[model samples]
Target: MSNDAPVSTTHAPQAGTHEVILEMRGITKEFPGVKALSDVDMTVRRGEIHAICGENGAGKSTLMKVLSGVHPTGSYSGEILWNGESAHFSTIRDSEHAGIVIIHQELALIPEMSIAENIFLGNEQTHRGAIDWVLTQRKAAELLERVGLSEDPMTKVKDIGVGKQQLVEIAKALSKDVKLLILDEPTAALNESDSQHLLQIMDGLRRRGVTCIMISHKLNEIEQISDAITIIRDGRSIETLRVREDGVDENRIIRGMVGRDLESRFPDHTPEIGEVFFEVRNWRVQHPVRADRLVVKNSSFFVRRGEIVGFAGLMGAGRTELMRSIFGRSYGNVLGGQIIKDGKELHLKHVRDAIDAGLAYVTEDRKSLGLNLLDDIKRTTVSAKLSRITDGLVVNEAEEFRYAEMYRKDLRTKTPTVEEGVAKLSGGNQQKVVLAKWLFTEPDLLILDEPTRGIDVGAKFEIYGIIQRLASQGKGVIVVSSELPELLGLSDRIYTIFEGTITGCLDKDEADQESLMRLMTNTTTRPETPAAS
Candidate 1:
């Protein structure tokens, strides 16, 4: 069988007397001013992989929270039936005790702790009120093996890559003796190979009779691994399709989740290329801790006016470091580099200097660096450029409100009002707010790292439209993304980075997945585009 084909031998779910292991009846979840889910009904057969499909705010995560006790009992109106018995869970521990464990898109592992410690965190191996060290290590090793991870149990979680950390989370779940495994957007941060491995592990779990429920926006993956798919549209359960060898396709899933046919995943726009407006020469950055060793080698690239240039590379390929070092020394110490804007060499010594020079960077980590969850929308919108709403010595609150309202409407940020705290908004809306924050800066150049990461397809299209609009306004755009298809679809020109160096550059017509991957891995004969400035 092909690698893309399903590993399951049985195309259908349990045929005979298998019981329904889980039933969520009349589930309605509500937040402050939003009704997330409405009277949703879902059932999962024993030992089958079930998938939930929806748009960004369609309440897939909220429904999973309700089931896993993140919402707890008395929080949402719902009836959870497990093994034909009504189950009321008041905490995550209650759900775990019942053999249901969930791994969210954001990993929950403590970074400083070792794999063994993280695995047996809450449920330690004990004897007569004393922890058993040998037993703990042995069991942690076994669970890690089950998840196809080769790392030592003594290794810390922070030292591992996200793909390996994903496996560690599964090992942690295995330590709980999970009978039902729930994964939310598990492969969003993973590459194609890592994603394939994760899918294989899910299939392995199904063969061992573990019921799995997955929520994902990747329609192809849903069509492949799932035995049944439940489509949620605007907080309503639309329909469930039972998978057969030839019964399902990507278009069907897209149409169901989006409530209409999405003919293209990206908005159409033609590039109006102009002279190179942004250029970096001989960029070299030293590692933050090990100053002797360089993290970004002699790299050079350029972006033209009204162009979307893409940086394609693997994890830790120095893309983020390069961008950060260029933007006001937010990262490592720059050993040598010249940043040129228009026709002038820029000497940006700090973040303030970079911002004043009309440069803005939207970091890849939105939670930690992009948005302040505690601040209100109005404040966040005017944060980067307070001068716009400030008087000579005092601040004008009405002007701030008006400015925030205008950008909120322009970006189509979905919130109750500009007074709504950013902590209450969804992932897509939070991303929009971040963009609004940078747009207020009136930047001539915008740097976006993983712009659409962890968002839904509909939200991705909206963001693409925003990028195209920005380009239309003659602002230079640089996009760094791990998703090759995203880079291929959006970029007017693409540069591949490997081991902190520029390996190859391809124009839009010459770039594809194979060429990009070859250059990314340094498999090309020589860089098609010159690296020397």
Candidate 2:
């Protein structure tokens, strides 16, 4: 699609028709050295999907934590009124006692537990203090049905895909007799089809008189589903807009979020294309566990210096697997492949070898794979290339701090200090830190997987500029993204992947959402344009 895609004019149904069921007055939450939320006021109707929109580190999640009692009553100075009565919750259980349940951005389910066990883990139905398996399974089955899930209750939580896992989370919430449900970035990790299904489930819950407060960076989804939107910016509530009454669109919500109209979602740039610096030929990788299965087929692609090459694919289309395998066989067993960099084939047997070969891969799952959350920013920034900060035996602390501080300022990472733990920063800042880690390696080729996955529009714009800046420095950047629009906006050339195979390639001028979708789905193939391989 073009940049001028029409804003959705559709409004939510029955907006502002119900009575106010939840309200917070002058909520102020503070940490050791930071005030997360200040005098934030919000109101939710008896049954409506309320959305919270803001840039990263704008206190949306912090506000939700206060409401759900994650911060507790005495910890934050706030008066919460539920159903016109003062409510002071001292713990998460206290909020749940009042039928308030929140599903965090990161799932809290146990991988080893069964779906039934995970659903009623802490709130199990018991008979004479003994665990009642029959009742648990039956109730879990019913809840699953309510959420349109057909999975068996006995199935392991890790066995299901992310979409189904999300449904299981909702089922778990339903088991609590929840009256008010909160979802933080619910669809951030889901594909389009699964995201739509989750939205439909939320709408169904609204009809069942369940109030929902959702914190999301996806303004388009917010525009489509929210009855009312509350835009939070810089630790304060900016404005509350009713979808029907105000006719709020993406741009309007964005303005409230960033305090200015975004004239362009992407920055304008003229390409300074150069010779091909990296090439992957006939790449094939076997599944890590399943030896008989091939995760990546005979995929072939190349990246040119000063050019941003985008890989577009659906979820489970092997995009991540391909990149990981190419980056020193990190994902699967590399059956056969040729990685040619600077016109010379290189053998990268390990991650260290990949780094030595002047290649860097920024993983999509930053929380798990890209970052060590326990470490501080200074440490994490140089962890990928400790040799740069180390003098044979010991790490030079001053050099580490200098590099961290430089990247922090250069990438515009929002943080009080480099000594702060990465877990304390927002998703955008953490991503910046991850980039800094890899950039410290001083790679000639950079592979970024879902670089802007859960970040806001403003942060995404900044990331795009950063990618372009890398390309401008004569580095070859390969971006693998689930977002088609992002590929169109940033990539000079885009390649489509399907079922572990490279389907086709298109230049910036030739690719659009529909065309790319067609190629991605393996429905059609474009002419294979030769790169510098």
Candidate 3:
């Protein structure tokens, strides 16, 4: 089977006759003007992997938060029955004490801490008044082995990759003797190989009689691994289906989540190609911290007006570094390169220069590098081009609101008002706001890095439509995505990168998963393209 294929759980027992380990009755959680979750019900059988499926703003995360005591007992109206006993958790500690541990989407491990320290961070193995270092390392090693992680317990967390960090989190849960494990979008950011390994680990946990509640947008993975899936929509409990008995598939899950059948995963788009308007020649970038390490080698690519160009590469293959370096040198140091747009050479030394030169880049890490969580939607939307709304050092709030509201309506962002904080918005809505921020810049060339990383299927279709609309308007778009199917479905032309080099360029007609993988891994010889000259 392919690495991206979902792992099979044929060895696991069916959940048909399993005992009920947890039950949440009428979980109604509200935040200010939004009823995040309303009358949401969920039941998890002992030793079963139960999945929660929903759209971005459908309150999947909110329901998990309530269950894990992040919202506390009094913050919401709910009855949680654990092993047939009523339970009230006023804090995260209370939940953990009850063996209900939740690993959030954003990992909580400190980068500077060692693996052992991170495992027993809060629940340290103490010797009288001090921490027992020997005992901590010894127990952490045992837990790591249980999760199939070969890393030493004393190794620093910063030295490991995201895949390894995730294993550490599971080891930490095992340290707590957790009975119920809740994972929220755990594999959302993981690559195909890492995701498969994590799924296997979950299956392993299930075998040891560990009950898991997973919230995910990946329907294929959910269908393969989960014994039962509960669908939530519009802040309400829709229905729960037994995976095998009900014959639930991705289509059925999509119907439950979106309230409609999406006839297609991508919006139909026909490219109106023109002469190449943007070109990069001999572009080379060095690592930001390591001057001797070249992250992006001598690479070149081009984009034509009214065209959507896709970039395909393995993780750490310099796809992002190449785009970022071109977009105002936001990432690595430029060793050498020349950017040509419309037959004119341009020099961009900073982010402002890139924006002013009609270039916009939407970063992959939206929460950290793109949007300011503390700011309101109106401010975030107009932030990239505040000069347009500013007059003589004074800002025009009306203009800000007008632009924000316009994009919000155009993008179909789900929000009560543009005045709401971006932190309150869902992943898809947050991504739309990021796109709006760049669109406000009125850039000629837009570089999107992983535009739909953690968004749901319905939202992905909408985002694809937005990209096509931009291309239809005679704009040049460069899309960098890890999902090859996305590139295949949306792009007119595709470029493959391997180890910081542009390995090959293939037109839409010649590109496929197999051919792209060949070029991406540098398995075949380089192809001559206009950029290669």
Candidate 4:
């Protein structure tokens, strides 16, 4: 089928009356024990940047899946109207043929392939059944430029970063002559500048008559760019707001999604800072892939026994690399560093050494690094300290289950049972499981990397409480977060990193969002007076 050709069964929303480009009426989707979407109704106008927002499991992604044909037409009860007519798409290709393209949160580009090859993968230009390499590269360059990407088209996808990869995905959609674009969390992993660039690109596309639907948790971005905002909660549409209308408040949008006014996004806490317990000195790390390049440069910091230390920086600022390298050299090549626990120097040559040294690093990407998805909660809980449940090489299942159940209640993890697979739990619950795993290890120093990322407001509050509780128990906690408000709200001490160097340090009393942002952006000048003085 021609990529640009409209599907025979696809109907476009009527052209006149502002052109309803897409309509989903009476959409109902059900899974075992879960009604994901219930008689959902949605309408999209032509060339508008429509934002679909909700808490996790709020049917935002499910509705997009239904539209993109990830859930085939027969699987859900719905009528899809496009360009003023009815449409039934049995497959993604069928929808794409009708100029509908979706870019999922998890990208689908082949890492080994070049950007040009990935963009024109399925619909490559061919002459006499042979791929037209020259034409393909030229067209790919044009598409890349359209998406504000200046990378060489021939560069392998693996060599580029996530922001560029997202742009490449957009370029691939443009190559398919996409008229309706659905982006699921396009800027979730992107830094502020990259996210802003992506939003600008979306605006550019809208001006070019491409209708866009974006799913995002970032309310600020939505408020800034969306022409319309639709809030869905519990598989139902709560309300839709026109940004151009008078008195459109962010609180109203949040209340619609959450069913309550979130007076504060962060929970209140009083940090009880104790004596210094964990300290890193003269820390340095080389890039894992490029051994010659230094990623973390002489980073030195300390967390007190009953304090939460916040690490703030832009993406690739070496925050995560510093934590990981100090944890056990789990990330980059350790060039030089000294970690001291209670005035005793410890060797962290390996992960086991770090663990034995009472150090635990909870990864930012928990799905791939922190938890074993296929394993049960009990198994995951004891994975970090199998020896605790082991009796002469034999694992004590009862002991493991008992510890898991205790932690489940302690952490307030919302799981049906400890026997349930960690994969079946919500993002917040999965994070709890990861925390439980490390807590079981009885670590003195805890490194939490984006511990509350992708969780709901309620879950975030609970997590904040947990962090405070950990500090209260004399555990030194270090948190790395992209959200500056989170760092300012939860931290006793804040350290700002910029381009692999620690640029500024501030106590909770002095670290406001604006000041932190200044330090994080590396715009603040160093004071002549000593910080201690």
Best by TM-score: 2
Q: What is the lDDT of residue 481 in candidate 4?
A: 84
Ordered from best to worst lDDT, the candidate numbers read: 3, 2, 1, 4
All predictions: root-mean-square deviation over Cα? 3.3, 3.4, 3.0, 6.1
- At residue 435, candidate 4 shows an lDDT of 88
lDDT of 2 at 386: 92
Residue pairs that clash (backbone atoms under 3 angstroms), model 4: 11-82, 12-82, 12-83, 12-84, 12-85, 13-82, 13-83, 13-84, 14-84
Query: What's the lDDT for residue 179 in model 4?
Result: 91
Q: Please provide, for model 3 over 1-533, each residue's C-alpha lDDT reduced to its tens digit, 9 standing for 90 to 100.
A: 12444478574574443899999999998888889899999998999999999988899888888888888989899799998899898999999989899997667888899999999998999999899999999999998887667888998886565556777887888788788899988776555555777788788788888889998877878988999999999999999999998988999999999999999999877789888889999899998766888888888889989999999987667888899899899887899989999999999999999999999999877776798999999999999988999998999988888999999998788898999999888777798999999999988999999888768899888889989999999999999987788899999999988878889888899899988988887745476566424
Candidate 2 C-alpha lDDT tens digits along 364-440 = 77776798889999999999989987888999999999999999998888788999999988877788899999989
- Winner by lDDT between candidate 4 and candidate 2: 2
Compared with the true structure, all predictions reach lDDT values of: 0.83, 0.86, 0.86, 0.81
Candidate 4, TM-score vs. the true structure? 0.86
Error of 3 at 417 (Å): 1.4
Residue pairs in collision within model 1: none
